[model samples]
Target: MKQFFRLMAALFLSLVLSLAGLAPPAAARGKAPERIPTILISIDGFRPDYISPALTPNLAAIAAKGVSGTMTPSFPTITFPNHWTLATGLRPDRHGVINGAMSDPAHPGVIFGKSSEQPWWWDGSGGPVHVEPIWVAAERAHIRSGIMFWPGSTTAIDGIRASDWQAYHADLPNHERAEVVLDWMRRPANIRPGLALLYFGDVDVNGHRHGPGSPETTAAIRDVDAAIGYLRRGLAGMHRQVNLVIVSDHGMAHTIPDHVIWLKDYVAKEDYALVSYGGILFINNVPGHEAKLAESLKKMPAFIHCWGKGELPERFHYGRNPRVPDWLCLPDPGARIMDGNPEHPNDGGDHGYDPASPDMRALFLATGPAFRSGTHLPVFDNVSIEPLLRRLIGLAPGKDRDGTVAPVEKALR
Candidate 1:
């Protein structure tokens, strides 16, 4: 009876030790551990204040595990432009994505017809990036990278692309997106991507359809929070180390129907071809109409402001690129601008105002072996993300970037 009991105890101990990989050393045990993979995620329209412990428990937990703080987005505070900033560490002006939709005489099509969704325009098929994005830099260094649905992911920038990439798709579920990225991370080390990016558009979609504080938008926020939690769990289960970074393009703002400013009310339709969305629009005008529209905009300075390409605000760092419009029309805070019957049917929420506005504050959080736990960093500009990302992936940053390393480096462990 004593021998039987001792044998049972020994069997249980061996099983536990084997599962823990502590029973004995294997031949591969002496090999160096793999360089940790880096996963960067973007949640569009995510506000810094949205990470309430009661509601966004997963994200809150991540903040507690690592670093969390405000990430100020670049001006115009729109989608494609700011996403590019995160990737390239260049402002919209320097990156040459001045607006989501605009007419580039060098690559002219229908400005309004394909404003925001034109992959060909952004993907280097029409016009290429002025600065090297980190993905391209990673590829240059012979490191494999993958990106899913990130703005410009489809762009083979300067004849280089992330080894694996997928363009934007509205119908893909968030969990499925996670699965696809995880599969890429699971590849053999010789071929596996060291840097991967994923984007979530659901919160932005709901934020547009419903105001930022609306119950529907809150539910969307919760959905995003849960997706992040699910992705974290899935990676944790893999028993490998991956550095995770969560970022947002910009936040949302409330608006009223009374705030709509129709372009036709100030100038005739033929004066300029307009690409309109809430907050701002690019004006491509007939040569003579440009001056006339400028005068009209001057008269309505209180309601709106227009700047010729040369006269744009210096702080914005816009207007030098040829792809930018002949004139820019900016609306006051809480106001919406439209060329015709509301360019988008969205009624309550809008962005693209001034980045200085508190309403446009974005979110940033990171948790992984690369980051320091229990650290809450100060607010940093979104452009600074590039240098930090390059460091996290163990790559050198491109020289052309305006982003300095001081802002985001403190997040490192």
Candidate 2:
């Protein structure tokens, strides 16, 4: 009996040893290394095709050593909506940021961004973001975050902790923006944020000012590229092993000056107010005139489609956001929405169209220890970005949402 007991004990010991061998290492026990200390850089209005040996050397170098692909922004393909979508990992409908300007039919005086004091924009201070952003998720997990000029970040969310953030401003120089980001990364507390978002607006601004592919746009792209190069070198000098994910809100297309559409021309100015940005036009018509204005916009030559607040394209996934206008008009590719008044001339290029258009498809590049080198993945929804960011920072998403969008696994080394 004693010999039998010894044999049983030995067997148990062997099984325990085997199980321990299969267990994950201490560093690898929780999440993939590729998911930590991630940096997402947004170069506004960056087109995938803009990446060439001639135009963007630094981006090319990163792409050569990492993964590159087209990342489709959320529907309506505008900046504010897509940028918010990227942070929330929810469709515009879910997040309620349908467009740059939105009108709340339920609340008589509620208009987002029509005037500075309007309470229409997402109130991060107390309001709930249907899906928690990676920043909030990271903060919940005791991780620090840093955001520089990312839209929607200016409004502080309840649980999200960011070292610093700024409201969206097209006028901020690219180099100055980079410097701010680097300073945040170098914070003495080793506050090198687990997640850092850097945005460069020159490309989009120049694209709107001089038209995409024009000399001014090209120069802006080069200038931003050089800034990125500086950032890359700076990060390396700091010996930070970060996963850099470069992305763009949307791309631009040249618009013919003659094809401009002025909403006031087709609708009574008294009944409707036009809120325009990034080539998206939102007409807030008086309650009774909503239908008439919608119809007129549909018949307009420059507009590709017009929809009532709830009838925006299924693909747009907008309408639900508090910021979406009551009546949304999408101009076709290479079209501009402008006031026909002689004072306001139609010039430059724009992007607020369907994101699927190649012209609106943006650039996405990922590099670092977490990303596989020299690879390309199929296009993905911009909303998937939040999930990847959460994983990198070792945090869980706030809400259990439709999990259709996941991290870019292909980018993992």
- Candidate topping lDDT: 1
Given candidate 2, what's the lDDT at residue 389? 72
Model 2 Cα lDDT, one tens digit per residue, 1-413: 99999999999999999999999878778854423477899988999899988899999887787888888777778777778777777766666666666655556665566123322354332224444566666767767788887777666455354766666666777888888878876775446677889988888878877888889999999999999999889978987678888999889888777777666667667667776643666666777876677667766773556777788666665675555566777777876666645343577788887777889998889888777888888988777777777666656554744333344776765
Q: List the residue pairs that clash in candidate 1.
A: none
Candidate 2 residues lying further than 4 Å off, grouped into runs, are 1-36, 105-107, 114-120, 123-131, 166-172, 188-190, 321-323, 340-344, 402-407
lDDT score at residue 232, model 1, on the 0-100 scale: 81
For each candidate in turn, the TM-score is: 0.87, 0.82
**What tens digits encode model 1's per-residue C-alpha lDDT throughout 322-382?**
7777778777767777766644543778888778778888898998898889888888889
Q: What TM value does model 1 have?
A: 0.87
Clashes of 1: 0
Q: Pick the candidate with the highest TM-score.
A: 1
What's the residue-level lDDT of 408 in candidate 1? 69
